[model samples]
Target: MELVSLNATHPDHGGKSFQKAASVVLHLLVIAALTYQIRGVARLPAHPHIDARILVPYAPGHTAVVHPPKPKIIRPKEEPKLAMKEPPPPPPPSSGGDPTGDADVELAMASFFPDPKPDLAALPHGTRGDIVIDIVIDQDGKVVDTQVDQGLGHGVDEAVLAVLQTWTFYPATKSGKPVPSKQRLLFHFERA
Candidate 1:
C-alpha cells in the first residue's frame, strides 16, 4: 500500500491545492462588489436647505408695557436742631503757685543766654561806660521790658540791652504766685 500527502508541496496534491486557492480569490472579489453597491445606496444625492428668520413683535394698538417707576429723588434735610454742648469752664485756676511758674521757664532762660556776663568786645578804643537796664520779669520768668538808662557809644549800650533780653529770672513772687517785678542789671564795659 502507498501513502499520498495532501500538502501543496507534495506532488500528488499540487493541482488540487491550486484549484482551492482560485475559489477562495473568487469569493473575496464577490464580497468586495457587494460592499461597494451597499455604500452607494446609503448616501443621499443633495443636502436639504433650511431658511431661518428672526421675528420681533411690533407694539399693536398702544399696548402699555409698564416699567417700574424711577426711584424717588431724596434730598437730605438740614438738621438745625442738633447743637454742640458748651465745653466745661476752664478748671478753676489751679490751686498752688502760678501754674506758669515751672522749672521749664528757668531751663529756657539758661538755654536762651548761657553767659550771664556781657561780652566787652563791643566797646573799642579805650571807651568805658556803665549801663543800667530797667527790666521787668513777667510771671512767665521772661524779661518782657528793657529800658536802657545809660548809653555807651561804641555799641556797648545796645549790646547790653540785647543780651538782657535773653535773661530769665525766678520772677519775683507775691503770695506764692509769679508776679511781674522791676529789676536792674548794671553792665560795665572797659576795654582791656
Candidate 2:
C-alpha cells in the first residue's frame, strides 16, 4: 500500500483553516434562510379562492357624421376694349450716318500716347519707380486692358495701374479706320 499526502511546498497550499470556516458560515446562512421561510408558510391560512373576469369600457350614445365640401362656382372674365391710337409718325431719317455705311474703309495705324500724365496719389515719400504695362486699345480709341508687363513693388504698381485706367489711349488705325491694338507703355513715377 502507498500513502499520498496532499500538502505541497507552494504558497497556494496554505489557508486550510480559513477555507473550512468560510464553508461552515455559508452552510449556516442557507439553513437559517430555509427555516425562516418554512415558519412563514406555516403561519398562512388554509385554502383561498380567486375569480377572473373580462372588463370593457363604457361608450357614448352619439357619434360624429362627416359631410363633403360644396363645389366652387367660377365667373367668366370680360375682354378689355383696346382704343386704337394712330401709330406714331415714322421718325425723320437720322442725320447721324450709320457706322456700317463705310465698310470699305481700311483701318489706319496710329501710335498710342497718353493725353496727360496719370495722377498718382498716396505714394510713399521719396519713393521712385518705373512701371511698364501693355495697354490694349479698343476700336473706339479707349484703353481696354492695362496688363502689367514690368511692375514696381509696393502700392506704387497699383497706383500706376489705377491712373493708367483713367488715361485715354489713341487707337491704332488700319486704312484710316480705328482698330484694336496692344502697345507697351512705361510710366516713371517719382515722389518728391
Candidate 3:
C-alpha cells in the first residue's frame, strides 16, 4: 500500500531560480575578463624611459635670424628723354637697275592642250577660230582663275576653255612668295 503527499509550495523552486541567476552573472564576468585580457595583449608597448627630444618644442632664442637690407626692386634704366622727333627718311635705292625687272615670269612651263585636235565629229562643222584666254596664276604654282578674253564660234572657245581648266602654271613670284600673275594663252583652231 502507498500513501501520496502533495504540497503547492516548494523551496527547491526558489533555490533553482537563484542558481540560474548566479550562473548567468558568472558567465558574464568570465566573458568580460577574457575580452580585457585579449585587449591588453593587443595593445602597444608602454615604454617608460623613451627619449622625447624629437618631440620637444624649440626654445625662443635658438632660431637663426637674418635681417636683409631693405629690398630695393631694381628698375630698368630709362631711355634718354627725347623731344618728339620725326623718323629718319629711308635711303633712296640706286637707279642703275630695273626695279620692275626684279623677277621675270617666263612660263617655265604652261599647261597646254594634250591633244590640240579632238574627234572632228564631236565638234560642229564650221569655221574654227583662235581663242585667247587670260589666266591668273596664283601662289603654289597653280592656275587659279581663267576667263575667255576672245571667243570663237564652231566650238573652239569651249574646247579652249575646257583645256585651260586642266592647265597649270608656275605661279608669279614677288619677294620669293608666289603672287597672282596674269598670263595670256592663245588656242588656235583651224578647219581643214
- In order of appearance, the predictions have TM-scores of 0.38, 0.35, 0.39
Clashing residue pairs for model 1 = none
- In terms of lDDT, model 1 sits at 0.61
Worst 10 residues of 2 by lDDT: 36-45
Number of clashes found in candidate 2? 10
Error of 1 at 12 (Å): 99
lDDT score for candidate 3 against the true structure: 0.60
Clash numbers, per candidate:
0, 10, 0
Clashing pairs in 2: 106-174, 106-175, 107-174, 107-175, 108-173, 108-174, 108-175, 108-176, 108-177, 109-173
User: Which residue segments of model 1 deviate by more than 4 Å?
Assistant: 1-113, 116-124
**Model 2 CA deviation exceeding 4 Å by range:** 1-127
Model 1 per-residue lDDT tens digits across residues 1-192: 888776437565778888899989989877655443321122122433543332223344544343343666777797457788998888655434435564322211222554445566766757777777787878888889889887675666666677778776766655555567677667666776
Indicate the worst ten consecutive residues by lDDT in candidate 3: 36-45
Task: Report the C-alpha lDDT of model 3 over 1-35, residue by residue, as the tens digit.
Answer: 87666765576989999999999999988866644
